[model samples]
Target: MENSLEFAQQLDRTDPLQSFRKRFYIPERNGKPLIYFCGNSLGLQPQTARLALDQELVIWQQHGVEGWFEGENPWLSIHQRCKKPLAQIAGANPSEVCPMNNLTVNLHLLLTSFYQPTPNRSRILTIGGDFPSDQYALESHIRNRGLNPDETLLEVFPRPNEHTWRTEDILTAIEQHQNSLALVLMSGLHYYTGQVFDMAAIAQKAHEIGVPVGFDLAHAVGNVPLKLHDWGVDFAFWCSYKYLNSGPGGVSGVFIHEKHHGSNLPRLAGWWGYDEARRFEMTKGFVPMPGADGWQLSTPPVLAMAVHEAALAITAEAGMEELRRKSELLTGFLADGLQETATVEIITPPNTAERGCQLSLRIKTGGKTVFNHLTGQGIIGDWREPDCIRLAPVPLYNTFEEVWRVGQAFADFTS
Candidate 1:
């Protein structure tokens, strides 16, 4: 635990998941692997991803149009193959998980079903400074329902000079707007601050007020432990490219609680959502498939799903609990190391339970220049606007020595 290279190397030697690092293709600069600390943005590609993609390519070349039903992994039911693994990752029933469209697209689709606004209870409650795509999707969806965003969108901001929201304040806001709150949309982990929200408690509080709750787990999924079904979350969606390690622009996954799956909840349905039994019959009425598959709008992208399959397989083998334990240690090491430096502030929560792997650093001055220096040294991390740099020590592929190197980079830059 000492702030020394030997200590860091010792920790890496004893890490249970150290072998996982070999599964990913780490990007290099000048013939050496960069100290990658940006898995929260986009994950490093899995070494098996190419093989997975190639399998599908071979299927396409051999079978062509018949590939839908005549292949080792048929295109028709490829999405279903991902359900069990995705469910394990998100802590939901296989029936409740569906691998489908992109994150924003899935949000719009899920909103169509869950974001129902009555005359009196039409406002949507969410946190401020959410991912821009989420904000855009929520605002546009509200406007689509003939509602004014300013009046219908209720955003909770952290107190002045604060970096994260307090759970008490979030619950208080929910109580105050219970009557007018139509939906409670929040992130499982804040992308910028790296603060984890009490999603289960938040969902319970919202449900007590008769408000439907959902979460965007873009930053949480694969990085943190989640129990969507146990939490009674009405719905949730996340992209696969981050901690999930699917390739860039990977297909996203959705979780619809079992309670809503059988309901006549309104959704923007498509042929893919139709009952598989009657799909070939070309039925007149749209009979939705059971569970989350009922929410899917189109045919699955086999290549993308193949990549997800490869990535999810890795997660399934490693297990979330094991990965999370390593994540806590890795981030904790980074936090402790950063605390020794004077020029930067670690804004992420000190408690391991309140964060994933990301640590958001606020540089006192020359933030971008310092970031550039880190990059030049092959220490890769993401720079957020204003003056913050985000670094994620991903448990699956990142190591303790890498965290030490980053701490050293910061000290060198500041000194």
Candidate 2:
């Protein structure tokens, strides 16, 4: 691969997914789209999102309360309609997926059922430097059970001077604490370093130790391929606002393995999770809807679900395998270009399978200065605390030309 503008243009010319870029509303500066490499943060809005929202609004205005059963897409089963697509993205049976509460809320709900702790097996094993919200949620959950976080929460961190956790170390920690470990919760992809964890291997190890495993896939879903059902994961949760492109603070999704669907696992149930067929009967006892739908709480937000439906449709049409193929090429191209530049270290794993679209650059010096320069020049990457810049060349909307331009900006700043 030549480090030339023509090379970038050629790659763009040959990219099968290049046309998908037009489906998004990229931010502009002086009539040109900014080089957006922050899909790992908030994704750009889809072009069809407004139409999707307007359709729901129209249904609301015309049908009023009758909208529940009186529209092309009925509100009563709006979330049920999302299950199949969401399941496709999660690699689960449609019965095993549900779009409902926000990410952390869903986490707590799943934990309520899965994180049953006894006197001996009471500790939760998780990786260190997880998203702050997860850390807080775990601590709160432990505290609610009259347990101390310091004693009940076991966190694994990277070795000295390392940016990501090793698979061996993670397995070792799980083995060492198997007696006390009640649940294993980890992120499918590390948010800061963009390293993809070996979720299947971890799940196998946790199951071997008689502990259930779950994943916080906030940064993984829609950014990479997942097989939660086949991996035998107990449960998982993720947000749609980032790589899923469902708007800011969009509705989140959850997955429960088919094996757990009809079992007598105790869940924090609500009216919505009640059996849909018998829900209107107003029965005294709770009969949970089979599968992940049993975990849903409140009524689905129609407007947000409208946006999610539109976004997931786009992802479905593009297909995850194709998206991942382009993602690997796009990120690899960026990595190669960044290596030729100076003053920044690529901290993400070089192996394509060990990462998704994001690259974490550890700036050698003047980190904020370089970031500001790139921002002023209309390069849209995010800056993490201390000294990292996270950039993601999202395959659905980003082009090779954009990757090349970001590389050139880094070269200019470092030069």
lDDT digits (tens) for residues 5-123 of candidate 1: 99999999999999999999899977999889999999999999999999999988988989999966789989988988999999999999999999999999999999989999999
lDDT of 2 by residue, 180-281 (tens): 999999899999999999999999999999999999999999989999999999999999999999999999999999998868887888999999999989
Question: Which window of ten consecutive residues has the lowest lDDT sum in model 2?
Answer: 260-269
Cα lDDT of all candidates, in order?
Answer: 0.93, 0.93
Candidate 2: C-alpha RMSD to true structure equals 0.9
Q: Residue 171 deviation, candidate 2, in Å?
A: 0.7
Error of 1 at 9 (Å): 1.0
Q: How many backbone clashes does candidate 2 have?
A: 0
List the candidates' TM-scores in order.
0.99, 0.99
